[model samples]
Target: MIAEMAHLDVVVPPEIVDNETSGETTVEEGNSVTLTCKARGYPMPVVSWRREDNLKIVLRDQGNKKVTVTEGDQLRLTRVKRSDMGPYLCIAKNGIPPSVSKRIMLRVNFAPVLEVPVHMIGSPLGKEVTVRCKVESSPRAVATWRKEPGEQMIISSHKYNVTEYKEGFYVTQMSLTIRNFTLEDAITYRCVASNSLGATASSVQVYEIQPQKTRTSTKNDGDDSRLGNQIPLAASDHDKNDLDDFYNELDDPINNYLDPYHPGGILDNDRDREPLLKDPDIPKSPTGSKTFPYLNGGGGEGAVGIGSRWWWWAWVVVVVFWSVVLPGRVAF
Candidate 1:
């Protein structure tokens, strides 16, 4: 029993740490990169990623102008650039002592690419037209069609209509149908295709209508007579002038009160009632001189009576007076 007096010591194994985790596993130039410091410990250890030289782990991409960083006991590099790439340390501590973690790597990839294509189809009156717009891209695209002048295109029940299709990654189609087309049916059509990157448009197609036949009628003697009968008898040139003069007199306040025949009797009543003058050789006065009896009242071309033979000098007096004084304001 004296052999049990000696004492012995036993060694224990280190506890397993947290699963490795990297903050912002992927990053872009001019973007902030955050590395997560997740570690395991018996009492939950504190974790952090630090630069070896104790210098800031930040890098500036002047060209891209971005920053990068991380959370959870990790280092954040803001506006990250190619220069920011280097070994980083992760430290963990449960108060027993601080422990560092393995470094994590982050890589950034470029964005997706996209493109579109323009397409067109022509149409005419009373006809159907087809058009297709195409799109090509790294991630595929979408295409659509609509009428220009107005949003919706009305298809006639009689014969025309439209059909649309969007299927494969590369192509799309739209069809326009026109029935019993008339000149009014002519119009321009357009198509459009687009993707995440950009959009494109097709050219306008103008529709033209065909011409139609027409008939015209000819005139005959009997037809002419019938038309003549249809016209009112009082619508003759003389009647027209009389009516016009009546209306003219109404409009002229200064002459409205004047009698159609007497017109204020500026000339004798016999001279005033005379008909319109006609071209004739000037008659010599009874006194045989060009200097005939001058009438004082003014107005031009009057005779003594409608049918009576009167001295031409009497009318000459009126003509000369009208020419000299009435031009400024011919009341009627």
Candidate 2:
């Protein structure tokens, strides 16, 4: 039992750590990340770190680029970017067989960015034209089109359409379609892509191609000769006065024929019914004073005229009858 125990103790390795450092990590840009590599061994093994894919680990803070760390059990990264994401290897071996390693995945999330080229083209009327742009982002972005110098979004309709295509996991193509194109479709159109992080934009110009017109010209000297041979016209004072009178008649005529609601129109078409232009009902000669007589106290009766020398006896009888019948009214 002593010989077996000695052999077992002699065969034990100095570094015999298990693979307990494997994990997954996710971090945003401009933030810090810490990766822990812990292990246990017979002689307390030392830790060394390296990239699994044989790539450079860039330290943007200290200007240390393409570096390899051969020490430290903890791997720290500050201001992590999207390009720093990959599998990391942590190996533990102190002259032992079957070496141990762990892969820690680090994910970096960022905002969307656009890299678009300017394109200008002329399209004919009643045709379809496409305005296309490209984008790159970690998370998928929502795309839209807006008319510039204005921020109002382009409302999709039968003549306008918006679409997107994914070229890769991080690259995409955003486009807009103008169907049955017209002159109004020519504008400075901008394509926008947005996500939780930020937004980016690009612009394209579309123009309407006007059709060329053909012209036919005729050259003839006879036309000028004919115009010269024609009599020269002259306006006399009488013609000018007639023209002025006609214009005045048109502006303020004696009657309005075209007006439907003219009060002067005789709808009955009878001269006796023209209320404004017809003769008045009053007589030319005045009536006798008998129509409304005045009292003559000298004769004790009402007379047709005060100039009359004689007062009729019938007038006295009428005054007595009226006074007796209507005592409440004054007889006149």
Lowest summed lDDT window (length 10), candidate 2 = 283-292
How do the predictions measure up, each by TM-score? 0.24, 0.45
lDDT of 2 by residue, 1-332 (tens): 35543334433343423354547877787898888888665555567778876777776666755687555687888888766776777777656555566777776767888766657877999999988888877667887889877677986788788877897446788778899988887888888888888988888889998877875544555676688898865678668889999987784432322321246543334343244223232112233222111222222222222323336556766898787867756553
Model 1: lDDT to the true structure = 0.48
Residue 31 in model 2: lDDT = 94
Task: Tell me the tens digit of each residue's lDDT in model 1 across 218-288.
Answer: 57866877888895656587788998999776655433223223346333364542331111322222322
Poorest 10 consecutive residues of model 1 by lDDT? 288-297
Candidate models: Cα lDDT each: 0.48, 0.67
